[model samples]
Target: MAFLIRKDFPLRGFATCGDCGSNLRSSWSKGKTKYYPYYLCQSKGCDSYGKSIPRDKIEGAFADVVKTLEPSPNTWCGLKPCSDVHGMRDWLKPKILRV
Candidate 1:
């Protein structure tokens, strides 16, 4: 029996190569505990290695981007309630958000 190897970032996910003009390939390195994931250029003769950017840093940046677009209480109140799935369902029932 043969198994297929799947990659996280596919061909469409590649942005661009730093050194070469080709597309960059993403891979992960096996660490002692977890895998160290990164993206690298597939072009030959390129001296550039995988960027050192981590997953958490990217997530934080994305959160900051979302925070910038957040609406104030006054502006948010004017919007109509969405569908049942999207709207608050019995927010008055109980509150135990914090530990």
Candidate 2:
């Protein structure tokens, strides 16, 4: 099958292969009746180098990880104001003064 670059793959550069520690690349395959999305490791010497993982499975696993990361409200509140350098400097000023 001819391979084409797809921009819709959300995890293209973000996901990594468990076995090879290489970034996972995604592509679409034309089946008999439909197109299927898959993520694969392209590393030359890795055990799972050419193995394809179904898109749903990879995305679902990412979703599961995101679900488990429930940051507390206090942490969010603390970080919300430090979104920029000036804000971070201001936030750190008080702590530095105390130290």
Top candidate on lDDT is 2
- Please, what is the whole-model Cα lDDT of each candidate in the order they appear? 0.46, 0.68
Estimate the Cα RMSD of every predicted model relative to the unseen true structure.
13.3, 11.4
Write down the TM-score of every candidate. Answer: 0.39, 0.68
Residue range 1-99, candidate 2, lDDT tens digits: 222334567655556788867777788889999999998999999998889899888878777766776678786776854447455544533332110
Which 10-residue span in candidate 2 carries the lowest summed lDDT? 90-99
Error of 1 at 83 (Å): 22
Number of backbone clashes in candidate 1? 0
**Model 2: clashing residue pairs?**
none
Pairs of residues at least 3 apart in sequence or in different chains that clash in candidate 1: none
Q: Give the per-residue lDDT of model 1 (tens digit) for 29-59.
A: 7889989865566656776654444434433
